[model samples]
Target: MSIQTGDKIPAVTLKVMGEKGPQDITSEEIFAGKKVVLFAVPGAFTPGCTMTHLPGYIVNADKIKAKGVDTIACISVNDAFVMDAWGKSQNAEELLMLADGNGTFTEALDLVMDGSGFGLGNRSRRYAMIVEDGTVSHLALEPTGAVDVSAAEKILALL
Candidate 1:
């Protein structure tokens, strides 16, 4: 079952690129006592994610923050290196690039989908959520291969 509104986020370790290397960060550390906007993509650098999904957040990050969001994070099932490179390429300095390496977090949320047909293996479905103090307040999931509901503007409107 995928996570839904009113569900507390599960405890899991995600990775992020640090100066030294990849560093582990816990879901608790991210959502605890904070209002956060988290968006997950199928993969890093894929056309929809690279061209539209990620950039929407990068551009509207400030507006989302202005609505009292403590952090705006982007998550993908890629390694930290690729997440870091993609963040830099998109100038996503204001957004947190989190790597769900090994699909731990995605699996925990019950949102993992098989993408082996496209040679991507297991990955996250496209979704976004507003988490308040570790619990989900709003969730937007794309039922198919479109970036309609999970856009930052939609999230901002929800906020």
Candidate 2:
């Protein structure tokens, strides 16, 4: 089943680009004691994600953090290298770029989106969630191919 507002974040490992290159981070470490806003896109650097979805977060990141959020992160099914490059390209220094390269974390959350038709294989559906110390308090899942409810503006509004 898909993750719900009351669900705890699943146990899985994700990647992030560090100075030493890709590094592994556990889900527990990310949410265990933090108020986090995590948004997931289908892929990194895709048209919608690049031009629209991520930019909304980039612009509103401080405003969201001011509302008591500890971290704002973006995740995609792409590799850490791609996510890192995209973050650099967008000047997303304020956000954490998480890479669910193998889609393991996405699958653990039951939020997998089939992208075989697009030659993208398994990917994550567009969604955003407010996680507090390991438990999700709010979840906004976007419709297929849409970027409405999961946009940063909406997440900011919720905050």
Candidate 3:
């Protein structure tokens, strides 16, 4: 079943490119006892992703954090290397770009999108969630092939 309100974050290791280096952070470590805004995208560097999805979050990171969020994260079904480069390209130094390289975390949350049309294989659907202390509090799931629902403004409005 898809994750719903009050569902705990899946216990999976997320690869992150931190200042020190690539580090493996577990869901518990990230979500436990913290309020987080976690957004997922199909892939990094894609058109809609680059122009609208990521930039919205990047520009509104401070506002989101001011709404009692501990951190803002962006996840994609790409490797740590790709996410790292994309973060730099987008000037997303403040957002935590997580590499769900294996899509294990995506599948576990029931959010992976089938990308057979583009031959990209399975990926994550665009969505954003408000997580509080390891459980989902609110979710803004985008419609298939649509981008509006998961925008930062939408998430902020939900908050």
Question: TM per model?
Answer: 0.99, 0.98, 0.96
Residues 98-124, model 3: lDDT tens digits:
999999999999998999899889999
RMSD of 2: 0.6
lDDT of 2 by residue, 97-138 (tens): 999999999999999999999999999999999999999999
At residue 21, give the lDDT of candidate 3: 73
lDDT of 1 at 115: 97
Over the full model, what C-alpha lDDT does candidate 3 score relative to the true structure?
Answer: 0.92
Superposed Cα deviation of residue 154, candidate 3 (Å): 1.0
Least accurate 10 contiguous residues by lDDT in model 1: 141-150
**Candidate 2 wrongly placed segments (more than 4 Å):** none
Cα lDDT tens digits for candidate 1, 94-126: 999999989999999999989999999999999
lDDT score, residue 29, model 2?
82
